[model samples]
Target: MNTDMTRNDFRTVAREALLAAVQGLVLAIVVLPCGLAFVVLTLVSLAFVPLGIGLLTTPAVLTGVRALADTRRKLAAQWCGIHVPAVYQPLPRGGSPWTRTFVLLRDPQVRRDLLWLPVDMTAGFVTALLPALVVFYPLQGIMLAAGLWRAYVPATGESTWYLFVPVSGQGTAFLAAVLGVAILAVGWRRTPRLLAAHFRLTRAVLGGDAELAERVRVLTETRRDAVDTSAAELRRIERDLHDGAQARLV
Candidate 1:
């Protein structure tokens, strides 16, 4: 029974580790292209400023970025179990494209999103790649153990290996496999926390304090509206009493 439970535990950990690795790979593939596109769009918009086409391009870029940020927030909620609440100020109605763009630009949340982009690109890339590396290292060790290195390096005096660790023969391969298993063991435990940390950072930069402020602002406005509404209702009741009920009594 103990052995069975141990096997099940190992299987569960392995499954989770692989899932995290796949999630990281997906994140990397999506984030890299999106980041590149956003950078390119921003540059194009700037370059087109003198040509006056920037007005069109700039707003489009901002809209795209906002959409992308929203998507990331949702992804964080789904994958990391934490919702980075939206803190974007509502855009004013009945404005020209340029006016609306300026409003978006002025928003603190918008600025935060912009600030998060480069960092996301860098840190996300690393986080996304690391899992796959850990997962695949064992396979590389297996290949080296099987002596397939001879086919690849027919005349090599030396060969460069990943992680700068040698996996030359059965002994080294065994070591490499052990190292890889250790990494896998540690990574499964850490991957969820790592993803959570990234989402927390996203929330911090994109909405943390700003979200609180927005909530406060909303509550204040609601309170004011409620007070005004009560005052108006009291006056209407007094007027009704004076014009109808009191007048009828008189």
Candidate 2:
């Protein structure tokens, strides 16, 4: 029974890790082009800001940027159980294009979203792709081990390195397979964690815990101030003294 349960646990974890890895592959592919488009549009629109064309276009582009970030937030929450809040300031309605443009520019969240685009394309792209790579890359080495190296050696006419093992013959190919199994052993433990890291990175930039922390800080300070004010009022009441406003009224 214990052996059966252990096998079941392994199967469950492997299934979850495979699903997450594939999901991350999809995310990585989608974010790359979207991030590039947004980055180019933002730069082009901002360049035209002085000419007034950017006044309208900039805000629209920024709205798209926010939408992209929000979509990632949704994906993070829905797919990875990571809750990232949207904390953008509301833009004034019925305003001129210039007013809207400046309003977006003034928003810190807009800057954060802009910052996240490049990062999503670069660091985020890597993180999102890593889980799939970790989980699947070893399979290629195993294929090489299983005589696939012959097809490659004739085609390439040279020795190919399979994860630092040179695969020119059966013995070397077998060595590649051993390395592959070693990598698979490591990946089995890390695939789901790697997938979660991608979403965690998204949340870090897209207002996850920082926004909550700031809100908590503000609430704490407000509560402290209220307590101090109440204590001061009680002290005055005990001493039968009136504050400035009360004394003036009396």
Candidate 3:
């Protein structure tokens, strides 16, 4: 891949990923209240434990699912470098809440995203763990090793140590520490690229020909609307001239 293109794509994907993370965090936060409410409702139901809990948790779960789906949609757009329509298809006229909910549940995009969110979340969590481990574990091990070396290395060893004494064990430990730090630096540097690649893969798998066709259709309609608007304005101007100035002269 072109490095510049990849960098640009990473920026876009990173923005969307951060937004998705925020959305997930928000949904997770919102679930607390909903969970409490569910608990209360379940207590009141007093029977059919599974069904009661399911009914009570449904709203929050559905909200979370939708938020995740939206995140995926945005990520898909960023990854594909295409603008996904933000506007949802309007509900059918006089549709009831149940009908709308059912329609959403049946939406291909929503189902795809619902299926993907857990995996995405897992990927994100794993990615995050890499830096933490690469940084913290190495630092911790180095500190422990250094302390052990310092305490245990014979202070009066080798005739009170030469001016440029090179302790083999200490040198090996220092090299290992340096290597760990290098690994961490490299991992941190590569994280954004990894994330972007994952996002691209996700977009490829979840984005279909139908979605692309819909986007093209939307763009076509938008251009047509713009042309019609310009023509309408010209007609209005002509009508105004004919009615006002031309008619007054006649």
Candidate 4:
């Protein structure tokens, strides 16, 4: 891909991921009260068995974490134009339910995803703060400008109009305002890049490539073992038939 195009793709992916995150956050905030209520109700029903509630909470939390990881992977593939192989292998049917559940719990990718959820949430929260400050600070400044102008402009003391005019108070305020706006704009522009960097860093630290290589190695070993076993079985069948038929003839 062209470097610029790749960057653009990454940006699009980042935007989608961020948007998803924002949506998740909003949903969490909105649903948190109701969720807590449900938990309380469950606890009451369970006679306040704290352990039971804790057990239930674990799966719910893990499920949410997995969803976030899947969303990230989808966004990465669709927008960032990076293809990552699925880390999960389905088990054959006829296995016991417990065995299947155990296999799922042991999956490295799922564990990594569980670990990443909190980190991603933290990063998203921090990234959001910059934009929030940018919006709030300028509005505060505007409010202050009006009051400051009225209070000091007609006073007999040192002239303060320099604070607002091209050569006065107005000029100084304008500069400050411009600086604030610049900071806000820069923060908005860099949010996507920061998100992309976080995604890449997490993938690297979590051993994504190592996991993939390990899976490939296991597959190769399995194929080799199957071939060997098949050859041995064939040899045994041939020997048995030959020995039995010859002995009977004798």
Most accurate candidate by TM-score: 2
Instruction: List candidate 3 segments past 4 Å from native.
Output: 1-60, 69-88, 131-137, 148-175, 201-210, 216-250
User: What is the TM-score (0 to 1) of candidate 1?
Assistant: 0.79
- Over 1-250, each residue of candidate 1 has an lDDT whose tens digit, in order, gives 9999999998887777777667777887888889778877877885885677886677788788889889988888888788787677787888776777678778887777777778778886776666666676667655665776555443653553535566545566556556656666666666656656666767776765776878888999999999999999999999987899767888
Candidate 3 residue-wise lDDT, 1-250, digit = tens:
5999999986785455444444434433443454354345433432432455544444345556556546655754654354333333444677654555556556665555454455445554453343334334555435534754454346575221211333335665565556556655555444445445545545554554546657876999999999999999999999998899877898
Residues 54-154 of candidate 2: C-alpha lDDT, one tens digit per residue: 99799999999999998998888888898877667678989999999998998777888999999999999999999888888889888987889998776
> Which parts of model 1 have CA positions greater than 4 angstroms off?
46-51, 151-154, 167-171, 223-250
Q: Report the Cα lDDT for candidate 3.
A: 0.51
> Could you tell me every candidate's TM-score relative to the true structure?
0.79, 0.82, 0.44, 0.53
lDDT of 4: 0.53
Clash number for each model: 0, 0, 0, 11
- The all-Cα superposition gives candidate 1 an RMSD in Å to the true structure of 4.6
By TM-score, rank the candidates, best first. 2, 1, 4, 3
Pick by TM-score: 1 or 4, better one: 1
- Local accuracy by lDDT, each model: 0.73, 0.87, 0.51, 0.53
Clashing pairs in 1: none
By lDDT, the candidates rank as: 2, 1, 4, 3
For model 2, the superposed segments whose C-alpha errors exceed 4 Å read 208-250
Give stretches of model 4 more than 4 Å off.
1-64, 82-85, 92-94, 127-176, 184-189, 205-207, 214-218, 221-225, 228-250
Looking at model 2, residue 6 earns an lDDT score of 100
